[model samples]
Target: MKYVVTTVWKHPVKIDWQSMRQTMSKSKDNPHVAEIHWYEIDETTHGSVAIYHSRDAYEANLAFMQEHRSNSISERGIEMFPRSAW
Candidate 1:
């Protein structure tokens, strides 16, 4: 399954891509995250579309979000199609 995780942080200055990358690196252990693509919507908003192999992966991601409150997930959507040109 594919999920589009959209988040808007109040403090754009605190947007730490490196930290997020590090956190995502732990996906090797989580194993649900197949791939992730992040986007900067604006100065204070960003989003990520992730591909999960199974429901376990999707739930794990949600659990992680609940535990980590630094980023505010304002909107979340499931992706019907998974493809990219870049």
Candidate 2:
């Protein structure tokens, strides 16, 4: 199973992308995480999408969110469907 975790936040001061990257780098030992990806929108929209592989997707998502306190996080499961038969 793959879970997507999205984080949104407003910084009191200008966000230092370098510091943020360093923070994320420290979580290399997190068991509930598989891959962490990030993106930014226009300006205020700053968020990260994390993909996790676990038997319990919901719990895994919650655990990841708990680790990061500065931002608001939301998690959703990804579902795929077959488009055609060969």
Candidate 3:
């Protein structure tokens, strides 16, 4: 499974990209995670699209973000599609 997560930062001042990179690196320890692609959309927003082994993996990662980066998140969304359908 794979998911595309989009987030808009209302409190951009609270973000530290360096710290986020470290967190993502640490998250790789989860066997369900295949890869993550991070993106920067101007100064106030950034997000990631990740490949996970299951929905459980996706939810776990979302939970991790909520716990660690709650202050920086303004809006968020998740998308999943069958690979063959796409």
TM-score between model 2 and native: 0.60
RMSD of 1: 7.6
Candidate 2 Cα misplacement greater than 4 A, ranges: 42-45, 55-64, 70-86
Pick the TM-score winner: 2
**Sort by TM-score, top down from the best:** 2, 3, 1
Each prediction's RMSD over C-alphas, in Å, is 7.6, 9.1, 6.5
Tens digit per residue, CA lDDT, model 1, 12-75:
2545668767866765565666676666665544565666776566776777756544233333
State every prediction's TM-score relative to the real structure. Answer: 0.49, 0.60, 0.52
**lDDT tens per residue, model 2, 1-86:** 66655555544445567866887786556677777765654354456666666646537556554544513232222112221111
Residues forming the 10-long window of minimal summed lDDT in candidate 2: 77-86
Candidate 2 residue 70 C-alpha distance from true site, Å: 6.6
* lDDT of prediction 2: 0.52
Which candidate ranks first by lDDT, i.e. highest? 3
lDDT of 2 at 42: 32
Displacement of residue 65 (Cα, Å) in model 1 is 2.8
Give the distance in Å from residue 44's predicted Cα in candidate 2 to where it truly belongs: 5.0
Model 1 local distance difference test score: 0.53
